[model samples]
Target: MSFPEDPIACMRSLQAEFGDLAVLEEKGQRIAFVFSPELNRRVLTDPTNFHSRFFAVRGGRRSAQRRVTSGLLSVNGSEHRDARRIMMDVFAKKVLPQYHETIVGMTSDLMADWQTGQLHDLNEEMVTFMVRMTGALLFGITDGEYSEELGTRIDHWVRQNHRVGMGALVAAEEYTSQYEQLLQMADELEVSIQDMFRRHRQAGNSAQRPDVLSLMFRAQGTERELSDEKLVGHATLTFAAAHLTTAHTLSWTLFLLAQHPDVAARLQQELDSCTAAGVPDFAELQNCTYLDWVIKESMRVLPASSYSQRVAVAPVTLGPLNLPAGTPVIFSQFMTHHRGDTFADYARFLPQRWENAKPSAYEYLPFGAGSRMCIGASLAMVELRTILAVMLRKWHFQIESGATVDGRVIATMLGPTSSVPSRLIAADQIANTVPVHGSIHDLVELPSEARTAVVRRAA
Candidate 1:
C-alpha cells in the first residue's frame, strides 16, 4: 500500500487495515506499527525489550545530518540514567519555584509590544515568545534579536527535514551547507552560554542563578558531570525541544479557544479569580483547575509529537504478535488519543472531561509515560500555565474570518498548516467591541487588504 499523504490518516489507515499490530516492509526492513494502548505501554515503558536507539536515531538524523554527540535523548543504559540524574535538579520542583519571576518577566516583555487591533500571526507570535523564553531560561540570553536569529536558524534546520518520498533520501552532501550553518549557530550559542557562565563565576553569583547552564556548571564535579561536548548536545536539544513543542501547544490552544468563546470566557474568569497579581506563581497556577484542563484538552486534540518509535533490542511479544530483534515498532499518539474507548465524544473539545475522568498514562500519552518520558515536561507545564494565564488575562484574540487553521505534521510535531491570522484586542475592550458570548466569527471584521494578505500568505 502507498503511504498516505497525511501522517495521521496514514496511521489510522494502517491500524484499520492490520488491526492492533501492523507489520510493513519498507526498503527490505520489517517495521511493526502498534496501535493498542497495551502494546504502546510495553514499547514505551519496557526500554530493555524495546530500546530507544531507534527513536534517538530518528531524532538525531535531522535533514540527513547526523548528531556529533549523544545527549540524554540518544543515550541509553547507565549513561542515560546518569545524565538524567544530573540534570534532574535543573527542572526539579525546588528550582522551578525560583524561575516563576523570570518566566513572567520574559513573557511580559514580549507582550508589551502587542497592540490592540493589530493583526498578528498567532503561530509566529507564539514562536517568538517561546524563542525568547527558552533563550533566557536555557542560556540566560535576553537579547531579543539574538534569540530571534537563533530561533530562525533552528527553524531552517528543522524545515530541511520536512521532505517526503525520494526527496527525503538525498545524499548527505545535499544537507552539508545547512547542517554546517546549524553547527555554526550552535557554536555561537555555546560560546554565549560559556560567557554567561564566566560572568556568573566572576561575579560570585553562579550558584544563585536558576538557569540551566548555571545548574550544569554547578554540577560539573558531581556524579552527573557532563563534558563540554555533551553540554552542547544537551543544550541544543533542550532549546529545540522545549520551545518548539510548547509553542505549538500554545498556538493550538489559542486556536481552539477562539473557536469556543464560552470556554475562553470561563477560562478568563478562572484566571482572574485565581491569580491575584495577574502573573501566577506555581502554586497559584496549580489552583487554576480550568486553565490546566484547557491546556490538557488542547494537547489531547493536537499533541506536539505525532508519534514515537522504539526498536526491539531482543525478541519481544507485543500483544499477540512476536517481534524479532532489529524490528522498529511505532506508536502514534495522534490516532490513539482520539480513540472512542478512552474518551467520551473523543472528537469534541471538552475541558470538562478532565474534571472528573482520570485516564491512565498509557491511554493519554501526551508527554509519554516511562523512564524516557520528556525530561523537560515539568518546565513545559510551568511555561504553558504561566504564559496562558498571562495572555488570557491581558488580551483576547479573534481569529480572522476566512482564515483556515488546521494541523500539519512537520518534522514529527503537529503544527498549524498556515499562519493563524488573528486580531488582538485588549481583554477589557472585548466587552465593548464584541459580546463576551459572541462567536469569534462575529468579533473581527478584517479589511479587504488584510484578508488578501492573510490568504496570500496562507497560499
Candidate 2:
C-alpha cells in the first residue's frame, strides 16, 4: 500500500477508517492506533508499563549525535527522572525570569527593521529566529551569524533522523541508506557540539553561559555531572524538539490569524491596550485571553505532532480491542482535535471556541497527556506568547494574496507545502513598523482593555 506521508491526508484516513482507535499489522509487524482521549491519558500516565523503547533507532539506540542519555526526553525510568531534575534547574522559575530579556530582545530585533507593503514570507524568517532562539535559550548561542551555522549542523542531523524514521514506518528497503546518512550527519554534528561545549567550559570564569549547557554542567550536585557524550545527547534532543516545534507553532498561529483578519484585528487591539505603556512581562502573558484562544484553536486544528505512538509491553484493553504486546499503539491529535463528537464543527478553525471553553484535560492533548507529555510544553507557551506579542506589536502579517500555504507531515512535525514561507527576508520591508508600548493586552484588539499581570502557573 502506498501510504502518503502527508500528515493531513494520513490523519483524515485514519480517523475515517478507525474512529478513535484501530489495529494494523503488515509483514509480521503489529501496530495499534488509539485516538480516544482516555487511552491517550492511560498511555502517558503509565508510561513505564508501555515503556518508550519505541524510539530506538536502527544504527543503535544512541541519538543522532551518538550521545547517550543527556536529557529527560530520550530516557525513561530513573535516568529520565534524574536528567529532568538537572534540566529543571534552568527552566525553574528563577531562570525563566532571566530569559525574559533574551525573549524580548530576540523578538524586538526581528520586528524592529520590518517594512510594510512588501511581500515577505514571515514563516521562514520566523523559523530561523525560532531555531536560533531555541539554541540561544538552550545552549546560549545568540550570535546570528553563528546561529545559522549551528542551526545548519543541527538541522542536517534532524532531517537525517526524520528520513530514517519515515523509512522505518514504510518498511522501505532503502532504510539502510537513510540510516547511513543519519549516522554520517550525526558524526559531523557531534564534532561541532564538542567544540562548542569545550569553549563554553573554558569560559566558565566569564559566567556568561546563556544556554542549558551551563545548567547541565552545574547539575553535578543533582546526583551526577553530565558526561560529554550525555551532554551532546541532551543538547541534540533539545535542538530538535525546541527548534522545529516553536517554528511550526508560530507559523500555524500566523496561518490561523491570516485566515481570520477580524481575529487579528481584535488581537492587535488587545495587545495595544495591554501595552500602552510598555511590553508585557511573563506575568502579563496569561491575561492575553484572545491570544491564548488563537494559539489553542491553531493547535487544535494543526498541532505540530498530529500523531504520536507507543508500544505495549503487556496485553491491554483499549476501547473495543485487546491490544497485544509489541503492538505499535498510535494516538492522533489531528482526529481528537477535530472529532465532531467532542468538538463541534471540529474541522473549522475557530478561536472563539476556546473562549469560556474548558474541555477535559483528556479532550485536549495537543501537547500529549500525562507523564510523557511534551516536556517543553510550558516553555513553548512562554516562547509562543513572547514571540506573538512582539511580532504583533511591531508589525502585522497576512498571508500574501494567492500565496499557497499548505501543510505536509514529516514524522513528528509539520512543514509548509511550498518554499515561499521558508524564504529569508530583511525585516525592514514590513508594514506597521511602529514601536510598541505599555502592556501587550492593552495594545491588542480586545473588546475591553484589561491590566496585565504575571501568570505564574506552571504548565
Best by lDDT: 1
- lDDT digits (tens) for residues 320-400 of candidate 1: 778888777778787778788888877677888898878888888888778988888888888899888888889888877
Compose the digit string of candidate 2's lDDT tens values, residues 34-112: 6777777877677776766433463555544446224456577887777776666667655666677789888888766
Name the weakest run of 10 consecutive residues (lDDT summed) in model 1.
434-443
For candidate 1, what is the lDDT?
Answer: 0.71
Total colliding residue pairs, candidate 2: 47
Q: Estimate each model's TM-score.
A: 0.84, 0.85
Best by TM-score: 2
